[model samples]
Target: MQALEERDYFTDYEILKDPYAFFEAVRSHGPVYQPPGRDYLIVTGFAETLEVLKNSADFSAIIGVQGASAPLPFEPSGSDISEQVEAHRDRILGGDLLVNYDDDLHTKTRALLNRLFTPSRLKANERFIDEYSDEIARQMIARGGCELMRDVATPFVTLVIADLLGVPADDRQHFMNVIDAAPPPGSLNTEENDFRGENHPLTVMGGFFARYILERRANPREDILNEFAHSTYPDGSVPELEELVKMAAFLFGAGQDTSAKLLGNSIRYITDQPGLQDQLRADPSLIPQLLEEVLRLEGSTKQTARLARRDTRIGDRAVPAGTKILVALSAANRDGERWEEPNAFALNRPKIKEHLAFGRGKHVCAGAPLARVEVRIILEKFLAYTSNIDLDEAKHGPRGNRDLNYDPSFIVRGLTELHVKFTPAEGVDLSQASSQAETAQ
Candidate 1:
């Protein structure tokens, strides 16, 4: 077993492409070690990963080299660079949003978000999620087979968020197009090409959402946007129009891609393993546990980066102030030290809930509960409407590179395309399943 310091981090494209091997390598090493180039401390063990996430005082998310000017990949040139970067950073970190802030600011924002995502509210939206999921499932069943990622997951989550935000039906297509144009992580080479194409969707969506907030301010509607428009600070002053727009952009941008990945990856996993699908079909009540297991085995997010605020020790490894730390959540979930069988997909795993799929600590995902609901709805609808689902083995690509490129993103993990076939449940009604089972009992 080699120490983490001995292993190559960046050049190992295979690590990014298929992280299961990387997870094994990390487990063999100690919990934490600085990768080559000394760019960041990579924490792979579950305990250490949790420690870094929970300890905000010792670590800060303020992107800088030793708290100095951090060299960003997207930094603009000329005199406008500083202003542009500052503006972007402010939009990302200055707000009381959970992702950007720590300590008191995170607490306040989390509290506000908690109120919006309460059990009652989630229950209320159950029917809405079910309706949308059923519609998508019906379409897939009708088609006999389809590309799961683009055709189903993408549109399903996009519309769900749009509907929840009360985006006008007429503008949904335009909204989706704008979102699709936005740069995804791991596509830095294509970033310039995308920027040259049209007004960046981030800017357009920000402007449109800001205008919507203003309209809601004049005539409040019963929607999330209206609530956001009217939401205020502790002093009772509403967030500025720009802030509201940024918030909307954050919600849409954050929610759309991640959820799509979750749906796509989970579906792929189930289809590839018929036994798991059969187990799920046998006991629908185990959906929650099964979902957790799937997320742990094939989570969307792989790693997150943080900056060391002070000279800190992570699992006996010394990290200097301003050092960047990459917490590999996906690796942590598969740490051999933590789980009895770390790599295998076990629907019955007792500790499935312990996975870091939604992350941990102050910056944990705000949309986790909603995402879980969406996934559950889709799975239920899929099982109910389809008799048998399987990956098209003929369509499977070579041994090394699969047909679907797992988006080359360290922050998120998911299939680029998932091809599967299913036998549609015709003549057999879903409502009849319960009656037949009862009769058997």
Candidate 2:
């Protein structure tokens, strides 16, 4: 086997599949280490990664969506490449994305996003989310087995965001179809920046949202869509129509894959350890804490890329302008310096929410709140609706020798599919369990 330094994190499918080992090896060098022959710096230390993520002025989020493997369009000349970034912003992949927005634009745009996650809106949608979770959990339990992503996470997460976004009920299936048909953005198999094409979720969904926003503006409705349609920045300026479409489309895209991945990752863990499964099933309240531990250990996003817009230093390391820094969220979350027994899953882990799974600073995931609720509720229902959950040993061999497939992408860590067997709870009514679940909410 080649040395750890010889691995290509972005292109190496093996590394992309199971990167914790590589991250562990990298951590031996220190929190932030530039691997041999690689132009980018890998930040695996929680503190070092946060320091970089927090200093947005020094680091441009222009590369946030794109993996660090993707090269920039221009070369660095001066100590500050802010002007270069602005000039060539269009050339950078995913520049127009909300995650890549910076300073004033980011602040104002995020203001509009905040409307979608308001307390009242989420509270109001609680019924729909619970109902949806109950239905999917029952379906999986009745069948005795499911390809977790296809049978559960994908459809569950897609429609949760759909209902919240108020996509017309009649057309919800079409939106799900469009999203399902396309491979997620920035998959490892595709060329960098090639994931968005004619059928891309953002493209197709943006087209629909544009029409919806325009129509809602012309003919108002008493719904979240209407609020989103009329939303204005804190500075009292309305964002352009294209901006609204991008924001809405981004909400769906981001919410779907990451949330689904989290749900699937959580279930995988639950199935792996029978004790953990029984432990969680015994107390459904522990489900939320379980989700936090899952997010920390196996978050959907592995690492996020940031470009150094100005010469800066992350602790003792000197970073010049135009450098790509890969903040390893997965690695950082498990940094031994930050957590006790980092590799172990502990639902009672202290300061659990402090993990970088959803990232930190300004670019923290806006849909994190929804993701938390979505996955937690789904797990609760799954546990209540089922007597037992276990991996389909035929498809995914025995514990030590498993055959699981993960998405071939460097940016996001997710399973391509997770096949699992489940048994429905005997003498337990889904309706009663669902009602109780909703009551606790």
lDDT of each: 0.68, 0.85
TM match of model 1 to true structure: 0.84
How many residue pairs clash in each candidate at the backbone level?
1, 0
User: lDDT tens string, model 1, 219-294?
Assistant: 9998877887888776565556765675676677678777888888788767766477778877888888877987
Q: TM-score winner among the candidates? A: 2
**Clashes by residue pair, model 2:** none
- Tell me the deviation in Å of residue 278 in model 1: 1.8
Residue 318 lDDT, candidate 2, scale 0-100: 93
**For candidate 2, which ten residues in a row score worst on lDDT?**
432-441
Listed per candidate, the RMSD to the true structure in angstroms reads 7.0, 3.3
List, residue by residue over 166-199, the lDDT tens digit for candidate 2: 9887677777777666666567657433535666
Superposed Cα deviation of residue 22, candidate 2 (Å)? 1.5
